[model samples]
Target: MQHRFLLGTRKGLFVVERTVHGWRSLPPHFPGLQIPAVLTDPRDGAWYAVVHHGHFGTKLHRSADSGRTWTEIASPAFPPKPADAPDIRCPMRGVTIPWSVELAWCLEAGGDDQTGRLWCGTVPGGLFKSDDHGDSWSLVTGLWNRPERAKWFGGGYDYPGIHSILVDPRDPTRLGVGVSCGGYWVSEDDGATWANRSDGMRAAYLPPDQADDPDTQDPHRISRCLAEPDVLWCQHHNGIFRSTDDGLSWKAVPPPEPSGFGFAVAAHPIDPETALFAPAEADVCRIPKAGRFVLTRTRDGGKGFETLTRGLPLDEAYDLVYRHGIDTDATGNRVAVGSTSGGVWVSEDGGDGWMPLPVRFPPVLTVRFV
Candidate 1:
């Protein structure tokens, strides 16, 4: 297993390390803060944490020394609402979407050539970009100004949020985005413009006739194969989907057994055909199937999947993995699983077996192997 992994939890940020003795936790950094998003930018070896302070609003912190030291940086924010701008109501809750940052849902760095470039997705359906290493951020108004945003409602949040951003490795300008209840979008011109490209992903949560509407699909999460950026895996609200042509069109794959409803999915670093999913019940029942903790892996795209349960719980386990709760190292052999139930586990040899890191964390939201 890798020597270290970062844990972003409901209560704070923790850097878990493996030592000669055992798993050693460097003192918790944001002790009482809620870390909603984290990013270990491979571009510059810097760590970024997006924290939420109930009354203080959302803030961004960067650690350049591998969690040893930290610095406060400017967080993503929306410009003041124009007095003449029309008020928009959330389609799901019928409440006006606030022109403020509710939560920083995701963080991703730009391509290797684009240093100091970062992307952030937030609740209320806004995308922000930073050009000076978090010194300042500007909302990507292209996506925010889209009319489809009015059709986008919440997934788990009251207002819709963008949780996944895929920066294509081949071309820094090419991008793929995943939103809860807002459908999939792609931009080939570096986010200056966008297009809804979720052609085949169906949303069983909607009326049968409108289930395939591209503008209202709810994709729980999406992962892109680093080795094959054209291939993308989507864990949708209805089922699992795959795209072989840069997310232009999606194909429904065999939903992994026990269930296909899950939020977390991990793609192999080197293999486009390989991926893993954390299975759960359905929308109302989000726990593991029959209280048995397991993960489904497919090495042959989505043609087939195998259940893995060697070192996971089998009875009375009720861990629910969030969209960003599971992650894979560069090699893809080392995998990490963090759950909302406060349990974290690692698998050194793919999904063969697991080793539980001895720590009681506050609901783990995101796990990143740095």
Candidate 2:
């Protein structure tokens, strides 16, 4: 399949396509603006971009003509804290968790059965659902109102955020969310109720006695297989984990080469036992291991990994792929990855090899195939 990409970068959002002559980039949208999240609705070809303003806060924009123009829409907002509600504080920074949206970290379209529906995951751990496209949004209190949220502290940011939202293909009401330092949560009634499901995910950052606590485990990113809905893969803070039962529980995959300590995991579209990862130095050092950047793929459910580095930086490399920086096309044959260093690469054969894309860019925050 011909591949097109939506690269949400620190400077703006870019739409690029692979064509007969060469890869071509369309005029960028929201130039020089930090676009942290973006979504291209497969349902109607509508595109959505989330912009973060240094002084004005977060905003959402939608484009129906493929980025030719955009219209601003309502961004997600936390309901005013109840007048009598108890104070909730962040454990990491020792600050009160504000009832506001700092950033819209991720966005996804609802299943086909739910027309005009959209799901937006925001920082401060709020999930918002929109029924009229981006016209309006209502906070999903099922996951938010849980008492466990009080313990959800920051992982990399001062406030915890929900960066991954997985909607089951077979059941529209069944949703899975991945929160940094908040653990994984599942809802079965369309965001009316939720259950923490990060059992077996370890947290090395915590004391040994609390290392296995489900409520505090940080999942850098979680992705489900498009062809096998129940299977999911996670690149966690402490290590790599896999969920064979729709994320109700997880089992750590044996450590892969270089390191298993990075963000970005892409489950193969057709193979439940296959997925891709970008490994990096963890904790204090978040760059590529030993100054070499590479991609790892597992064909047998992480039993082992084969590192792919055909076109990647192998010396003095400092690229780090964010949680949303890598993606795979529907056929699982084409893969794309962007990094903090503004480097982009594409693999046309299941990551067997890669080639750099011809473009200079700002740090890429998120990349999604369109």
Off by over 4 Å in 1: none
TM values, all candidates: 0.97, 0.98
What would the per-residue lDDT of candidate 2 be over residues 63-159, giving only the tens digit for each residue? 9998888999999987888988777899767799978898899999999889989999988899999999989999998788899999898876778
Q: CA shift at 31, candidate 2, in angstroms?
A: 0.5
Q: Per-residue alpha-carbon lDDT of model 1 for 1-370, expressed as tens digits?
A: 4678899999989898777886666768899898989999988899999989988988999999988788999988899988987888986668998888899999999989998999999998899999899999999999999987888888978888999999999998999789998999999999999999899999877789988889899999999999988999999998899999988899999878889999999998889989989999888899998999889999999999999899887689899999999899888998999999988898888878887777778899899888
Which residue pairs show collisions in model 1?
Answer: none
lDDT (Cα, 0-100) at 351 in candidate 1: 76
Q: Model 2 off-target regions past 4 Å?
A: none
